[model samples]
Target: GATDADAAVAVAHPNIALVKYWGKRDEALFLPVTGSLSMTLDIYPTTTAVRLIDEPADVVVLNGRPAVGEAYTRVARFLDLVRSRAHRTEHAMVVSTNAGPTGAGLASSASGFAALATAAAAAYRLDADDRALSRLARRGSGSASRSIFGGFVVWHAGDGDGTAGDLSSYAEPIGGEALDPALVVAVVDHASKAVSSRDAMRRTVATSPFYRPWADSSEIDLVEMQKAIARQDLPAVGEIAERNALGMHASMLAARPGIRYLSPQSIAVLDAVLALRADGVAAYATIDAGPNVTVLCARADAARVTAALRAVGDFVDPRTAHLGPGATLVPGED
Candidate 1:
C-alpha cells in the first residue's frame, strides 16, 4: 500500500503548438474552444516530485525557492484534485524544477503540470493511463495535456457541453518518424509576461472581433498540419505554422487593450526567417503569449537558422531543439 510518505518523481518536456489553443469554452474545466497540435521539444524539461504529507496545508517549492501567491495556490489546487481522487485528506509537498525559463510563453506550465500530475498520481496511488493522466494535466493547464505525449501531438478540444466533456478532450501522439524537424527557440525576453496566457486568452475571446475568424480557421489549420506531417512536407508544414501563429496574434492584437507578445527583437527574428526563406531555406516563425519566437526548420537547416538569428544580434540566446520524448517516470528513485 502507498503510504503518505511515499514519494514519486516524473519528468516531462515542453511542447510548442503548431496549431495554437487560445480560448476556453469551459474555463473551470480548462476546456479549449478549439483543438491544437504541437511538437515536444528536446529542451526545457520539468522534473517534479510529490509526496503526501500529514500536514493541514500543502507545501510547494518551485525551482529551489519557496513558492507563494498564485504559484503556490495553483499547485495546492491541483493537489486537491489528486486528493479527491485518492480519497485522502492529507496534504502534499510538491517540488518542481524547470530546465528552461518559466512563463515567457515557452510552455513551462505545460511541462510543469504534466510532470506534477504524473508524479502526484504515482505518489498518491491513483490508477490512471496516459489518457486519464492527460485529462488530469489539462485541468491544470490546457496545453499541459499535450505534454503527455512526444514528437507530434494533437489535443482534442472536446465538445463544449459539460456532460462528460473531459473524456473527449485528451492528447494523442502523431507519428513523425520519417521527418527530421527542428525548432529554433529565440529567447527575446526571459522574464514572465505582464499578462498571463489565461487572462490574455479570455480577453481576446471576449473583446477581439477577429477571435471567431481565427478560431474557425484554426480547425482548418489543424487538418492541413496533420496532412503535412503525414507526408513530411516541411515547406507546407512551415507555411501553415507561420500563418496560423500570425493569425492567433492578430486575434489577440484586436483585443481591447491589444496583447502584443511580439517585440522588436521578435520581429527581427521573424524577418530573419523571411530572409532565410528568400535564400531557399524553408523556415517559419511562431510566437506564443510572449516576446520569444520559435522558428520551425529542417534539422539540416537548424544551424543556418540559428546563425541567421544570431546575426540579428538582439536575441539573448537561441537554442535548436529536436523532437523530444513523451513524459516518463524517473527510474530508480523512490
Candidate 2:
C-alpha cells in the first residue's frame, strides 16, 4: 500500500551559456567542461505532475506519449539516483508538459527534466534540499542542474573519482552559492537548428581542436563571471558571457566536421546587439547549441531591447518580454 500524494510542479526554462559548459567531463553523470551560468526564462517553461501509486511498473508520460524504452530508461536512471537517497518502495507515475513548442531550439529538456526531478522528489516526500535536487537533476542533463534554482546559477564541474576518468564526474555550484536575480529575454526562437545538444557536444569534444582551449580557458572566465555577478556589474557580466558563448561556438567551428549552429538570422541578431552597444545601450547576446539567441540585459532595458530587435525585420513575432521567477513548488499543490 502506497500513500498517494498528488505532486504538480513547474520550472521555468533556463538559457545557459555564460561560461558555457560545452563538453562533458563525464557522460554518465552529466558533468561539464567547466562552470556555467544561466537565467531562467519567464516566457517558455515546463510543468509536470507526479503521483505515488501501488503500480507494478514505473510509468512516465511525456507530452501525452507513454514514455517507454529509451525515454523510460533515461528517466529511470534519474529516478534511481532519487531512490538511492529516499529508499522509496512505491512506483510513481509522471506526466510532463512543456509550454513552448518542442524542437523550438529552446531549453525545453532542461526545464522538463528539472520539473520532473522536482515532482518526483515531492511525490516521494524526499527531504532533500535544493542542492540535492540540483545534483539529482544533473544526472539527467548538465543544464538541468541550473534549472533546479531560478535567477543566475552556476554548475561547477566537480572532479571525477577515477571511475569515470578525471573529466567524468558530476557538476556542482561554485562557492556554494547561487547568482543574482536577472531577467533573460528570447530575442529569436523561430530559427531552430538541426544539431541537438548531446550531438553537438559530442562532435565538439571529439573533433574540435579548440575544445581543449575552451575548457582550459573557462576556469578564468568562471571566476570573473562569478565576481561580476556578485558585484552586480551588468557590463562586466555581459562582456564575460558574450565572449564565453562565442568561445564555445568557436570550438564548434574548429571541429573536424566544422559544423556551426549559427544561421544568417543568428548573425543578424548578433549584429543587432553590437548595433545597440554602439548606440550606448548596454546589451549583449548569448547562444547555446542552437540558432536561437538569448539577449542578456537589465530589467529596465528589456522593453527597449525587444523593440530594437523587432525592428530588425527578420526577428520573430511577439517582441514583448518580462523578467521571470525562479523554480518553485506550486502553492497548496505539490
Candidate lDDT values, in order:
0.91, 0.71
TM-scores for every predicted model: 0.98, 0.85
lDDT tens string, model 2, 196-296? 77878988999999999988887889889889878778889889889888998899999888878887877887888899899988888888777777777
User: Using lDDT as the measure, which candidate wins?
Assistant: 1
Per-residue alpha-carbon lDDT of candidate 1 for residues 228-305, written as tens digits (9 for 90 to 100)? 999999999999988999999999999998999888888888889999999999999988889999999999999999
Q: What count of clashes does model 2 give?
A: 3
Error of 1 at 205 (Å): 0.8
TM-score of 2: 0.85
Q: What lDDT does candidate 1 reach at residue 231?
A: 96
